[model samples]
Target: MIPDNEDRDDNKVYFFFTEKALEAESNGHAIYARVGRLCVNDVGGQRILVNKFSTFLKARLVCSVPGMNGIDTYFDELEDIFLLHTRDHKNPVIFGLFNTTSNIFRGHAICVYHMSSIRAAFNGPYAHKEGPEYHWSLYEGRVPYPRPGSCASKVNGGRYGTTKDYPDDAIRFARSHPLMYQPIKPAHKKPILVKTDGRYNLKQIAVDRVEAEDGQYDVLFIGTDNGIVLKVITIYNQETESMEEVILEELQIFKDPVPIISMEISSKRQQLYIGSASAVAQVRFHQCDMYGSACADCCLARDPYCAWDGISCSRYYPTGTHAKRRFRRQDVRHGNAAQQCFGQQFVGDALDKTEERLAYGIENNSTLLECTPRSLQAKVIWFVQKGRDGRKEEVKTDDRVVKMDLGLLLLRVRKMDAGTYFCQTVEHGFVHTVRKITLEVVDEERVEEMFHKDYEEDGPHKMPCPVQSSIPHGAKPWYKEFLQLIGYSNFQRVEEYCEKVWCTDKKRKKLKMSPSKWKYANPQEKKLRPKAEHYRLPRHTLDS
Candidate 1:
C-alpha cells in the first residue's frame, strides 16, 4: 500500500491485493488479484455505506503471456508490488511481479502500470451481469447519466445522497467492470528479469537511487524464495532504444535458507532490511572502503560510496555522524586525483624555521638529527650547511656517521662535526629544507662535570646557562637525547622556507624522450618488400 500524498494530500491510499471473496466463492474456492483506493481522511461513516467503504471500488489485475490458443496462459498471481517514487517525487510508478496459475505454462512475468491510467479506468462505464451464474460483460447501453460508482454525495442536491443514492443497476454494473481493459507494459516491452528453474520465484522487490561519481542511477534489490537477495541495475541506451539489466551482486540474508517474505530499503541510511519467517537482517548497501588501498584502484571502481582524500581513501557514506559527507572536486574518479588535490600543497618554502636548535653533547655521546619527509615519494637530502669554502656539500655516511633509512643522521659527537646541518626534501624536483640544526659540542671537562652533577644530585641536573641568548637555560639540552630515542624526530619541527629555485633537472626529465617513442636498430618485424636482387628479375636477363 502507498499513499498518494502528492495528488491527494495524504488522504488517499492505493492498495494491491489478492483475496478469495466469501460470497462470490461460496460454492467452492477461487482467488483473484485486485487494486483499490481508499480515502483515509474519512472519519464518520456514511449512512448508506455504514462502516463499509463509501467510495469502495476494485479492479482486476491482468497479467498474462500471449499464446496461440489463448485458452489458459494467464498468470493472475500478483506476488508483490513496488511503488517507486521518481525524481519528481509527485509521480510514482507501480511494478508488479506475477506468477502463473496454470500447471502447463508455469512461469513468472513482471508488469508496469501508471496511476493515472488506473484512475481513468475507474471513471469509465462499469461491467454488468448479462446472464445467470454471475456472467459479467461490459454494459453497451448508456452509462445512466452521472454514472454509478461516483464518489459525489448527491446529484445536484437531490434527496438521495452518497453511494446510497446509487441505483441497484448502477451498483451491480460497477462491481462487474471493476477491471480496466488496457494494461501497461514494462519499459523494455518484456519482464525486466525472469526465473523459470522451477525451484524458486521472485517474491519481493525494493528500489534505491544511488548517487555515483557519474550521476544518479536506480538499483533494484529483488528477493527470492531461496533466501537470497539479488541486486541489479538497469542501464538505458537511447541510440538502441533498449535497456541493459546487470546483476551487480547476490547475498544470502538468512541463516537457515528460508524464503525471504518481505524486504524494505532505508535510502538515507543505505541499509536494506530482509525479513523471513523466523528472523530479520539488515545489510549495508555498499562497502566502498574495501575497494582497494591505492587511489587508482578506488577511483577506477567508480563506487558511489568511496572517495579518495589527499592522504588516504575514505568512505563517503559512512554510518552515524560521518554519514553526511560533502562532495569535493577530489572525489575518486578515472582522473588524476593527486593533481586535482594540489590546491592543498604548500607553496612557500616547506621549512620556515630560522632559529637553529642548539645542543650540548660529550665527545663520545651519540646524537641523531631528524629530517622527516612530508610526502611518501619525497627523498630526504642531507648536507653540511657550512664548509671551508662556505659552500653547501652533501653529507657522507660511514661507521662514525650513519644515515638511517628513516631520514635521520646519527653522529658520534665530534669536534669536526660541530657545525650547522641542513635537511631538505626533493620531491618531483621541488627542493625545500625540512629543518636546520646547529651542533655545538661542549668541552669534555664541562660534560664530565654535568654527568657528575646528575649522579650526585637528588634533583634534576642543572646545566650551565646556555650561551647568552633569548633561549631559556632550562631547555639547554633541547631534547636531543629524547629525539634520538624516538623515530618521530622528523615530525618535531613545523616550518616552511619562503623561497624558490628553478628545478632545471625536473623540467629536463619531463621533456626527455618517452620510452613509447624509442626506436630500435632491427626492423625485421615490419613488412618488407622483396630484396633488391630478387626483385631485379634475374639481373635484367628476362628483359634482355
Candidate 2:
C-alpha cells in the first residue's frame, strides 16, 4: 500500500508487493519470501520449518547462514536443494549467494554437470583419502563434491575442514593446482558508475562497476546519501598524451542533507530529478546557473555566439539583425528633420508621450536647415509660414543666448556665418558630415515682375530699332558675319580663322581698316581683305 501524505507525516510504514512478485506467484512458484522469520502485525507472524537436509530439487530456497555451523551445513539442511537448469538440462546450475551477514559481503558461483552414475557419494573427509566409498543407490545418485579450495573461496577456508590433525597438504595442493578451480564467466556486463551527488564520493559505497550510456559516461549527477546533489562531468582532452578526465562543476542543492533514495535522468529535457525520502527536486542541466564544465562560457572565455545581456550571459543567433534588435537607441535624419527611433514606446510619468517638437530654418527662400544642439541650457524655437499658394518659409531662434561665447555665437549666426559646416568628432577630430547653407538677398518686386510678366512678342511694345545690321556690304556686320565669310561658322572654325589672319602683317593691316573705309575701298582692294580672300577665287581657278 502506498502511504498518503498525512500517513507519511504521521510516520506510518508502507509495504508494497512489486509486480515481479505477482508474476512469480502466477507461475506456481514461491519467488518472494522474507528471510528468517516473517513479520506479523506486531511480532513474528508465522514460522515455517524448512528441512535443511534434503536432496537435490529444481527450485531455489532462502535461509540464513547460522553463526556457528557455517555455509556447507546451511546448504545441506535445506528441505529440497534446488539446482537450476540451463541448456536443455545439459548444463550445470549457477548459484548466487547473497550474504547479508553484515555490511561486508561476497557472492557468486558456477558449476558443471556430469553423468549421475559417475558422481561420487559424500563420505565426509575420509572419502578423499580412500577414493570412491559408499555404493551408489538409484534413489540416491552419487555426485562429486568439488575439492576444497578448488573454486574461488568467498570466505576464509579454515571453517571447512573437520579435524585439526587433517592433512593441510590436500587443501594447499588444491589451491596451487590450476585445474582445481574453473573460472565463472559472468552472463552480463557490469553496470556503470554514475556519481549523481555532484561529487566523487562513490568510493564510500564500494560499487566497483556501473553501466554508462553507450560507453560514454560524459555526465554524472551524484545524489548524496544526504540529499545534496552534486553534478560532475568528465571531459576528454585530446591534446594530452593520455586523455584526462576532469570534473567540471560541483553544486550543492539542499541547505540541509537528506538521503537521496532514487535518481532519474531525462535526456530529452536535459533535466535530472532526484527522489529523496523527504522530497523530490529537479535540476535542469543546462539552466544558466547550473552550467556544466563543458559549457562554452565556462570553458571558452569568449563565445562568439553568446553575449551578456545585463543580467545573464545567453546564446544568440549570430546575425547582424539580432544585434540591431538589442541596440538601445537609433537616431535618424531626414532632409532637414531629425527623429529618435525607439524599439517601443516608453511608459511612465518620467517619459513624455507627446510628439517631440522639431525646429528648422530656411535661407534664400530655397535652402532648409536644421540642427540638433543637444544641450540642457539652450532651447531653439522655429516658426514656419506657408502662403495660400503652398510656398513654405521658416525661421529659427535660440531663447537662452544671454551672453554667448564667440564660438557659440558664431554657430548661432545665420547664412552669413554659414559656409559648409562639417561635423567634427570631438575625440578624433574626424569630419563626419557637411551641412551647407547658401544665402542670397533678393528684390521682392523684381522677382514678382520676372515671374508674372510675358515677353513672348505678344505684347504691344516693338524693339527700339530695326533688328538688321547697319554695316555696308563689303564691311563686317559685327565680328560674326566676318567670321562666316572666312568659313568660321563654328567656334573651332573661328579659332582657326583668328590663328591664320593674325599670323601675317598684311592680313592684320587690312583688318585694321574701319567698316566705313573698307566699304568705300575698290573691289580689288576689298578682295585684298583677309576674310574676303576666302570667298574670292584665284585667277588660275577662273580659267579652269
Candidate 3:
C-alpha cells in the first residue's frame, strides 16, 4: 500500500504511471492531464497553466443556428471547436461541439440546413414557434424524413425510415460520407493496475508503483507490514509476458513487529527509505553493483574474480551455513605472479632517465653476499652492501646475524647498523633462498641538510631578491662586494656577471631541493654577527 503520508502531502508526491512521462525524447513533458483539473504546480513547485479544451460545443452550436433552442444541453462548453460548416448551407451551419458530461453515444448531435432557406425560415413564423403550438407541429409533415444524398435527410448515405436506425445509420453515414463528417479518435492512455499483495499477505509487501529508471532497468521498492523493506529490480520479459523480479535488498528494521506503510528510493544515492507505522528506516547501498543482482549465480559460480559476499547475495546460502573456505595457495601464487609481471612492465617503462641512472649507480656499487655456512641452527644470515672500493672491489658488510622471526630482527637493528640488508633463508640441505632489498639509513645531519637545501631552492629565499639600497653618487658598497664575489670588480661588468650567477644559483637550488617543505635552516645563518664598531666605520672613512 502507498503510505498515507505520501498521499496526504501533495507537495512531496510524484505520480509516474505512464510511459510518456519517462521518455527521453519527451523531456519530461506531460501529454495528457486529468479531465476538468489543472496541474497547478510541478513536483518542485513550478507554476504552469494549460487549457483543457481549445474549442467549446455550446459556442459552436450557437454560431451554427443563432436562435436554436435546447442546443446547450447537447453541446460541451469546454470542447474544442473542430469544424464550422457555414459554406454548405444557403445561410450558415456550424458543428463540432462535444458534450462535457455525456459520452459520444448519448449526447453527440449535429445539424444541416440550406443557407438561403434557413435565413428565410428564421424571419417567418418558424422563428416565433414556441410553447403548445410549436410542440404540436413538431411531428407533423414539417418534420423532415432522412433521405439519400441530401444534407438534411442523409443517414449513412441511405434513407432511414425510423429514428430507431439513426445511431447505426449515422455511424455508417460518417464512414461512407467522409467529406460531410470525420470521426474523432480517442486518446491513447496506459492502463491502471492497483496491487494488493502486501496488505493481503499481512506482511507489508506492497508495490505502490513501478518506474523506469532509463532504458536499462525498472526500479521497484515494496513496503511490508512488519517494517521490512524490499528493493526489487524488474526487467520486462517478452517471453514470459511479465516482469522478472530480482530482490536487491530485504531489510528488517523493527525490533518489535510493525507493518511498513510505505517506501521510497533515492536514485542518486541508490538508497532505500522505508516508512513503518511507528518509525522510518533507511538502507544505503554505496558502491553496490546493480548488474550483480541480475544473473547473480553466474557471478558466484563462474567468475572467480568476483565474490557474492554481501547482503544482496546472502540469500543464495543455505540455512545454518556460516563459514567460507579461503582460496587455494596455488591460485594466490598465480594471481600474484601475473600482477607483479604487469606492474614491472608498466612501471619500468615510465621511470625517469635520471632516476634510472642513479639506481644503476647504486646497484653497481652494491654487492650480493651469500652466507658461508649456507645453513645455521635457529639463526638467519643477512647481507648488507656498504659501498665500492676505489679499485671496484665489492665491499660486503654483514648487516646482523639474528634469530629467526620479524620481531627479533627488528629489535637488533641499531642506528649505525642501518643499510640495505637481504635476509637469506637456508634449510638443512645447505640450500639458500634469497630475497634482496635496499634499505636507506637517514641520520639527523642528513635530514637537516636536505631540509636546508629545499628551503634555499624553493622557499621564500628563491623568490626575486628585493633591491638592497639606493646610492646617490657612487655604487652601493654591498653591490660592489657582490660583484667582487662573483669575479666582476668594475661597475659596468657587474650587471651581466650578477645576472648569470643569480640564474645559475636558482637552477642549482632547484636541482638540490625536495618538493616538500624544508625542516632545517642553513648552518651559515647561525654564524655570529660582526662587532658594532666594524659596521659604524666605512673603508673610506678609515683611509681618510
Clashes of each: 8, 21, 22
Return the lDDT, model 2, position 425: 12
Tens digit of per-residue lDDT, candidate 2, span 1-544: 1111222221112121111122111333223211111111111001211221111111112333224545331111111111333344433332222212222332211111221211111111211111143221122223223332221122224332222212345333322221101111222211122112232222111001112211323344444555444433333334542222233223344445656666666654656666766766666553332221222221121212223332233432334465544632211011011112112232211112112211122223332232321111123332233324533332433442121211122223333422332211111111112122222223434444433442342243532222245535664322233333324334453443333333344544544745443221222333444431001100111100
**How close is every model to the real structure, measured as TM-score?**
0.48, 0.21, 0.21
lDDT of 3 at 367: 22
Task: Give lDDT for model 3.
Answer: 0.29
Q: What is the C-alpha local distance difference test score of candidate 1?
A: 0.54
Worst lDDT run of 10 residues, candidate 2, spans 535-544
The model with the greatest TM-score is 1
Q: What's every prediction's RMSD, in angstroms? A: 24.7, 38.6, 31.7
Candidate that scores best on lDDT: 1
lDDT for each residue of candidate 1 in 133-214, tens digit (9 for 90 to 100):
7644565777643354444322223334345555656555454455443333345444555556575678888888766545
lDDT of 3 by residue, 449-468 (tens): 55576567557554333233
lDDT minimum window of 10 residues, candidate 3:
535-544
